[model samples]
Every structure is written in C-alpha cells, then in structure tokens.
Target: MNKIFSLLTLLFMLIYLPSQANDFKAVYELAGRHFPWLKGKVDINPLENKKQGDAFTIEVVQNRLKIEATSTSAASRALDWYVKHYAHQSISHMGNQIKNVSKLPLTNGKISQSSFVPYRYALNYCTINYSFSFYTWEDWEKELDWMALNGVNIMLAPVGTEMVWYNTLIKLGYSDQEAKAFIPGPAYTAWWLMGNLEGWGGPISNEMMQQQVTLQKKILARMDELGIEPILQGFYGMVPHDLKKKIADADVIDQGNWVFTEFKRPGIIVPTNKQFENVADVYYDELKKLYGSDIKYFGGEPFHEGGKTAGVDVPKVAQAVQTSMQKHFPNSTWVLQGWQNNPSDKILAGLKKENTLIIELFGENTNNWERRKGYNQTSFIWSNVSNFGEKNGLYGRLQRFIDEVYRAKNSEFGSSLKGVGIIPEGINNNPLAYDLMLDLAWHAEKPNLDKWIEDYTVYRYGKRNPKVVAAWKEFIHTVYNSPVDENGKVLYQEGPSESVFCARPSLKVNPVSSWGTRKRFYDIERFKKAVAVFISASKDFKGSETFETDKVDFLRQVMSDKADLAYSNMVKAIEGKDQETIKSSSSRFIQMLKDQDELLQSNSYFTLNRWLNQATQFGKGLPDAKLAMYNAKAQITFWGPDNNPKTTLRDYAHKEWGGLLSSLYLDRWNLFVERALAGQTVPPAEFYQMEVEWSKKADLYKPAKSNKKNLARIQQDILK
Candidate 1:
C-alpha cells in the first residue's frame, strides 16, 4: 500500500509540474522580447500557497537569477528585484530603459520579500482613450510586460469592446450602418463606454472592428498567462439612442447628450423589461464566443458621470445588472469606478457585498472610501489619477501616496479595503511617482522619502551624485509635495498646471484648459535651482539616458517658467502702447517657443511627431488611414464637432510636444502676434479656421534628432 501511494504521488507530480512551468513561460517570453540581456540567466519556480501575501525570493549565483515565487506575478516582481537591485538597471515610465551595471551583483544567500497587499491594479477609463487608443499588438505586449514587472494583477482591459458592441447590436437585428453609427471612433470610445457620448469620433470601419476583436484575444491570452486578471466591459443595459427607432419596440430611454449637445450619448434599456435580459444574454454570449469565459472580473458603470436617470428605478436596475453579470460570469467580481458620487447609496444597497469592488478613483485628492463608509461596506480599491488628458507635466502628491494607502489599511474600514492602484489619465510622465506607488503594494512598512529617493536616484541614473541628489530632494519638497485644497469640492478639473508656453498667447491666461488652474503653489526660484543642479550633472553623466532625458525635461520646465515673464512683458508693452515693444515682446515669446521646440527635438520622448505618428499607425494601409490621422490630431487640439463655434474643449488635450510647437503652436502664435501687432481684437474665428486646417494636413512630420555634440552645447547654454 505504501509503494502504491508513492507511485500515485509520482504520477500526480508529472501531471502538475508542466502546468506550473507554463505559468512562467509568458514572463520568460516577455524577457526574451524586451530584456534579451537576461535571457538564459533567469529561472523561476512556483512556491506552494502560504498564509502570507504573495511572496518571492531571488538568489544570484555568478550572474544567473534563480527566482522562486508563489505565482507568475511574484516571479515578475523577483525579476524586477534582480534588475533594480542586482543589475542596477531601470525600466522607467513609458518604457524608457536605463542601464549601466556591467555585471549582476553576487548574492551570498537568497534575498526574499513578501507583499503586504494582494492586488495591484492599473488603468483608468480615460487612459484607454487618452494614452492607448492607438496601441497595436506590439504596444500591448510591452505594456502587459510592464504591468507584470510592476506587480499589477488587476487591470482594466477594454481594448476590443467596440467589436463586442458591434457584434451584439447586429445579432439583435440592427443593420451594420446602425451599429457603426452608434459606436464612436478609437479616440472617443472611453466616453461612449461610460455612457457619456456616442458616435463622436467615428463611424468605425468593419475591418477595424474585426481587428480589435482579434487583438483583444491576444491581449487576454497574454494577460492570463502572466497571472493578471482582466476586467472586461459588462452589460449594464446601455443601448444606442437610435435603437428604439430601429427595433420599433425597444424599451430605451432617451438619455440626452452628455457635455456637448452635438455628441449624443447612448440610451439605457429599462432592466424590468423582459427584452432587457434577452439583449444582455446576446451581448454576453457574443462576448464569450469571441473572448472565451475564463474572465474573473467585469467592469461597467450605469449612469456614470451624471448620466440622466429620470425614468429608471436605481436599485432595481442595479440589482438586475448584478444578477445578469453573476449569471453570465459566475462568482465574478463587479468592478465599479468610484468617481463623483458613483456607486450611490441606492446602487450600493443592491449589490452583493462580497462580490463587488469599487475603485476609489481619486485617492490623491479625496478620501471617498472613509467619507462613504468603505463604499457602504462593499470592498474598495484605493487609486490615484495623478495625471489627466495625458498632458505634459512633472507633478505628483508623492507623500499622499505613502500616507493614504497606509492610513486606509489601518482605518476603521480597513477590512473592506481590497488593494491599491495607479489610475493615471495619462502615464507618459512622472516615472518616479508610479515606481513609488507600485512599490507600496509590497513594502510592509511606511517608506522614508529621504531613504527611498536616495535609492531611486541611484537606480535612475546608475550612480549616486550629490548634485543629482540635491536636485531630487528639492523636487520632492516642492513640486512633488505641492498641497491640494481638499476643502474645495471640485470635480472634472484638468490635470496639473498647464505650461504657459503651450497656451495660446494671452496675457490673461488664467489657465490653459477651461477648468484648469494656473496657480504655482511652490517656490519657482527653488524649482529653477533644482533644474539647474540636474542640468549641471550632465558633464558628469552625459552618457546616461536618464540624465539626458532629465536635462531636456528640466530645460523645458525652465523655458516654460520663463514664459510667465515673457507674457508679463507682452502685457506691459500693450499697456504702454509701444509697437516695437509689442513686436519685440511678441517676437521674444515666439522665439522662446521656437527655441524650446528645438531643444525638445534632442529627445524622441518630447517630440510631437511621435504622438501623431503613433496615432496615424492605427489605420496603417487601411482606407480610413487619413481619417484616423485626422481623428488623432483633432482629438488632441480642438476635440471637436466644429458645428458649434463656441466649444470650450479646445486645448483640453493640448500637448507640449516638439513638432506641435513648431507647426501648430507656432502658427497660432504668429497669427495671434500679428493680429495684436495690427491692433485688432484676437480673431477667434480665424484661429479656429487655422486649427481646423492644420488638422487636415496629410504631411508626415519627423523632426531630425539634433546631433549629440549640438545637444551637449545646447544643454550647456540652457543651464548657463
């Protein structure tokens, strides 16, 4: 009997070992694709389940990495451990590679660490449209790898939702044209999915719809293999506003337009109607046919962001939605975005407390979880949206990230807090902010900013230099620690202060966007000193990409700051009635913009050409390629339906990028300056015309990289 038991155990081991090994193949494949340097040097083994949170260990022998972890996600963290600690390399925000260590550090014994938190979530609804609307498969591969390495296990994955909507509508007897007209283009899908606006950015091509479905399968497959749970779009009774016209008997409410009247938002179907469950079944059935039924989370919001709910019974609709979701995806958690009075008391009253999760959308600015009683006793995830509209800026409430997550976990409702998340609207800037936020998931104790920044500087630039350290310290104290006015109940505000340099030339430019603030709460002079110190370190570390990027970045900030002074002079010239002064001041302002644009050309990260190019690539070799390019540019500039001449969304997604400065902003400046020089009120009509015309230009712009020697010379001049 003992021999028979041993033979049975041997058979069980043979069956289980490959499944465990397969869990890590995605991580190795990711390393092979992105970090080829660590190809044969990494080995990962699965650890048995334990009482503690997800744990990992790394033992370095010679140069090889032996990683042991509870799962594939923990193994990725272990790989990050070797890369950050043993290899002294960094894969920063926007996937910037900073490498310098020639050899991996030898370890005497295994180094082990365990996470205090179980879930690390990432992404915002706006992030889908703002940052990744144009992403292809290659882009998603790198992104999934980044999420794995950063230990993000739960992410909002709505890439192919357009196709899901299209297929479902067609199955319900709607024509192809009707389906296409209801779905928005790539850039506007987020708002459409949120029931904000529909059919604004597009009449999506059938080919593109099919392409998205195929792409999402690949994304879901890779995410599954990497141990990340994808939160897909769920059916929440939203129907196209025109569905009633098509179906004749459809029980759709006439939900009005969202923010802009020209853009019609989707209508809602009453959940009590017998047809509602039938339509929902078709939607989820179509979803499973295309994407499979292995999903663990479903995310959708009913009446999101002030949608009209006049005829709907809030709790009954909520209950019906949850019931349908559970029926389709058994035991799946419903992930809701806790933004601006969402998950209202009535809605919360209808949910199954154990199977629902709310993402506290603005943890850096508000304490919604505490104020709302842990979302009325339902589980919640603490998340920060530090950036908005993918705007260019260097700002974050750093200490808030450290304090709030810790405080929440210790609060009266701590037991209901499920995880921590980074839900930035745009994620191209503020690398350190994201790095620190993700690290909080694993750190058992509150981190000392002083010690953490010291280590960050070393890993960032591959060495510790006092000049760099001093600069970062000032950054932490000032821009990084800038205060928020929590007393004010402001919602829908634009991101961090917009750079005056990027604004349309105006003396009274209160803010760049309609809802943004122009206030600088920190000491500008100290920030300048910080920039100077970072620039001065170039002579010591010119070969470092991190240093080079920071040099261009600091110079950009210094120039942006100088714009305030330039605008002041321009206003003074107008007041004094001096044409030459006005001309000189305007000329100086334009020159400053031109000079900054040239300086920004030194780094590809700061180039507008890259953004436009990436956006255009979404429709490569397709008939709608030009239309896609037009959508890309229009979304960034005059986010339009130019039918209304008095739209307020102009410059809402403005970029401080290089090519845009030279072409778009430069043209706007020259026109504004010329009109001012001629003593005429600014021509809003002409400026709008210029913007619309610029969006139509099919000319591809690729700024040549300034030579390294020239970049070095320019860096020195900017610093001095």
Candidate 2:
C-alpha cells in the first residue's frame, strides 16, 4: 500500500501541473518554442521567495525538467539555466548556441538560485537609439527572450512616447509639421528623449509613429508575459523649444543648445506653473491611453547633461514633478539616472524617498553610490555603463563589477542597494562582460571567477576547448582588466579603449570618439597573445556560429592595435623625412586596413552594409527613406550640429565596420597619405564637407566578398 501511494505521487509529479501551466502559460510556451525538447518534459510550480527577491529551483529527474519559480521571469531564467548547464547551450547577442540534442541531461539533484537584490534592471536611454532604434517586432521578440533568460525584471521601455508627445502637442494647437519637427530621426531619438537635442533626424511620418505604437504594444505584452516591468517616459517639463511661440502665455524656460551651438534643446516648462499640471495631465492621459494604466515606474529628468538651471527653484520644481507623477499614477516610482550631477542633492531633496529609485549609472568609473551614500539612502541599483556610443571593443572591468557589487552590499548604505543592471550605451559587444554581469544578479556570494569562467566556456562554444579557455583567462587579466584605486574605484577612462583605425589621419591621434581615448591601460602584448590563442582554436570551431563571430571580433581588435604601430612608424618616418620609410609604412597601413576590412566582412555584425541596410529596410515604404539612410550614415561619421567642425560631437559614433573602413576611414587615410607622399598640403577642416556629402549620398556601401575561406590562415598571419 505504501509503495502504491509513492508511485502515484511520482506519476503526478511527472505530468504538468494544470495550475502552474495556466498561471505561467508564457513561460511554458517560451520553453516549448525555444527548446522543443522540453515541450512535455517541463513542469513549473510557484515558489514564494519575497524576502530573497525572485528565485527558482530546477529539478531535472527521470528525464523530465520540473521548475519551482517565484515569478515568470524566474521561470524563464530557470529554463535558460537548464539549457546552458544540462543542455549545454547559450543565448546571447553574439549568437545563440542551441544545438541538436538527442536527449536532455538529467541532474542528480535539484538546483536552486536566488537574487542577491530585489530588482534586476536593464537598458539605458542611449541604448534605445544606439542599439535598438530601428528594431522591428521580430528584433524585439528575440530581445525580450534574451532579457527574460538573463532575469531582467525591469527595463526602460520608452518606445511609443513619440505619439504621446504628438497627440499632446496637436491638442495644444500646434501644426502637424510643427509637431513632427519636435521629434528626432530614427537613429537620433536617444538624445531627443534626453532633451539634449530636438528634431535632428526627423520630421517622421504618421505611419512611422503608428508603427512605433504597434511595436511598443507587442513589446509591453511580451514584458508582461515574462513578468518584466516597463518604466514609461514621464512628464518632466520637456516641451518643444517653440512652446513660447505657440502659446504666448506658456511658462516656458529657455534651454540653451546642447554641446553644439546650432542644435536646439527642448524647452522645460516649470512644474510650479499652472501650465505644468495641464501639460502633465495630457501627457500622462495620452500615455495611459496609448500604453496602459498599469505602469508603476516613470523615467524623466531635468537639466540632463547641460541646461540653464539658473533661477529655477529645483527643490520645489522637483517636488512638483514627483507629485504630478504620483497624482497621475498613485504610488508609482520615479526613476532617475544617477549620471553626473543631474540629480543633484537639490533634486533629491524634493522627492518622496520611498517612491523614487536612482540608477547609479557609471559604477565602473565612479563611486557615485558610495559618494552620494547610496543615492541619499533612497534605494538605488549598482549599475554599470560599460559601453558608450555602442562602440565595439573587448571590455568590461570584470573584477571591478564583482568587487563593486560586493562592496555596495557590504557598505554602510548596503540596505539601499536594490539590484544590478546592464546599461551599456550599445549592448552589442563584449558577450563575456554581459554574461558575467547578468550572472552576478543571481549570486549571493562573490563567485570565484576562476571556476565560473570554466562553466562559461562550456556554454559559450558548445564544449570547452582548452585553447579558448586559456585565451579567455588571459583576456580576463588583460584587455578586459580594470585598474582601480585602493577603495575599488576605477581610474578614470571612458568606455573601452578606442581603435585608432577609426580615427582621422593625423601625426598624433587619440580616440575616434570625443571624450574617449585610444591608449591601452593594459599590456597590449598580452592581449595580442590572448587573441592568437583564441584564433588557434578556430580550427576546432571553424563552422560554429558563436566561435566564428568572436573570431572576427577578436581578430579585428588585434589588427586595430597593429595599425597603431604602423601609424607610429609612418609618423616617425615623416618626422625624419625618410621617403623610403614613409612609402613602406604607408603601404603597410593601407594594406592592413584592406586586410582588416576583409576579415570584418566574415560577420554581418561587423559590416557597414548591415547597419545601412537595416536603416534602409526600416524606412522601406516610408516617405523619408532616403533621409533615413542619411541619418544612419551621419550618426556613424560626423555626428552633426549642422556641419560645425568645432562641434566636439563629430565621430562620437565612429564605427569600424568593414565597408566603413574601406569607404570612409580608409579613404580618408589614403587621401592623407597621398597628399603627404606628394609633398602637398592636407586640408584638416575640409574633410567635414566630404563627410557630410558622403552621409547625404543615397548609395549602399555593400559588403564585398570576404576572405572567409582563408580566415584561419589570415588569423594566423595577424599573429605573425
């Protein structure tokens, strides 16, 4: 009788629980579709872990997978954990590694993991434009899947705010042209949202506005299904700079041009004014009508980067802003970016402590959490902006990421450390950094990365290759390395080390992007050796997607570094007036660029055609298709304030893609080299004209044939 009872219980456990399936249909379907092998082999049950934040337990027994999760997000993560560990697969921006598995691996015992903090956040305002500005529903579907697998519970999703503003502006008696002019182009929306610049890339069509609205609805639905929260853009006093012109009595404050003198920043209407509530009500009402009323978080800031904050009663103004936010959606949290001093003590003083959350944005560089005492003890997340302008490089201070998280949790204001985040300007690079950082959210104690990285290798490339593992270990100590002060604060550096190949030709060059550096803080020779080791394993993973993608990126990096040497040699040759040396060095530099371009062509992610083609495809059937293409080109080259060479924003979005290198960067170098060799003067400022003209040209810099067949031989040659 006892044996019969146990067998019945086992039968019940092997089958799907109806309650769990009904409650988490999204997770069930996600697993079923993403991993078909787990269709009926999976059972999800609810587990309460309120105190420990979202938690999950995986029990793979008797050739079936059973999961007990605190939330749907947790369940999704559990599915991913199973895929990576038992199934030996990985899902990342670099590539997804789900191979043909005949049978699932059974675990000897149950596996459980919980978050160290209550909230897991992701995305940056810049990430919206720099990474996902032109993303379609298909793009967003994959993105949300990646988010769920990584356990990102809350994210900044300001996709359809354009329509909200348009509606609100139209109601205020603005013309259609005037309203669309307030919005930015597709590629330049990040700065527009930030109130830095307005209407640079756009005068978008009504069709595109509707497209965003539809896309956002799908995104929000998926987020809801995955148990991820969306932080909508809120009413924070940003209005078109011509608001005074439209409404003569409007209490509009003049916001000076941002960085560049020509580009106009949106005006701010003080929340203390009667017009503030009026405008706020319309914005929030339209927001609710367009999106939904269930949103509990709002993201908007005043005087971001640079704005005239003079004579504004910041405390009262801030108090009114939060009051308006809560009044619109009672008990909603106001999300503030802890970027520089935008959220000054004056700004913090006016908010309700329990209702505000600060995203401590540059944790890798600044100890703002510590310096501000955990954002004035108002509940903050320890976050890192690892990448700026989405520039590609093998970066992320892996040790610093670990050290800072632990440091915050053990600090005096540890109680206020709510979670971890990945807020890269562009989140397309450094798979190792993102994977390690996201995994940090689930760790209760500091993981000895020496072992953690071993597991990473197995998941990353299907099976752990010794050469690849050794290369990664070397990477962890070299290019991916971070030097910090005694207090674990990083020595100041912006984003990753820049590639000099992207820079315009000069005797002395630094970073391609303004406020960035070309200097390597780590031993370059060690990094080169690591890349060689990585390339050596390419023979084993020749046809592997993840392996080949990384091979291209790693090889591209080493070649970039090699160009610096050629540049230095050429400069030295020029200084000595040695024509023979000049000819040799210049030839090598141009040849190196040609070789690098071909190598980058091996991967679509590293090709210029990919970017332009995306923009072209996105604007398909739209009225401004050609203009849209121009925005894509302009963004990567001389990012504009209307052709001002003195505007430090030029080359701020420089991309070292295959076609870009061959067409633009390399062309510029060839011109510079030719002028030098012929003893002719090279015009410095005249290049801006060439850049603008290139941006306006409606031609595709299509990816030509790459030497993919000879990739291994060429990679070996790079080391030689």
| Model 1 bad stretches (over 4 Å) | 1-19, 98-103, 260-262, 484-494, 707-720
Estimate every model's Cα lDDT from 0 to 1: 0.81, 0.85
Which run of 10 residues does model 2 get worst, by summed lDDT?
705-714
Candidate 2, residues 367-460, lDDT tens digits: the string is 8898887878989988899898888777888888998899999899999999898899998888878888888989989988778788898898
Candidate 1, 161-217: lDDT as tens digits: 988888898988888888888888888888888887878878878888877888899
Model 2 clash pairs?
A: 185-201, 185-202
| Best candidate (score: lDDT) | 2
Cα displacement (angstroms), candidate 1, residue 597, comes to 0.6
lDDT of 1: 0.81
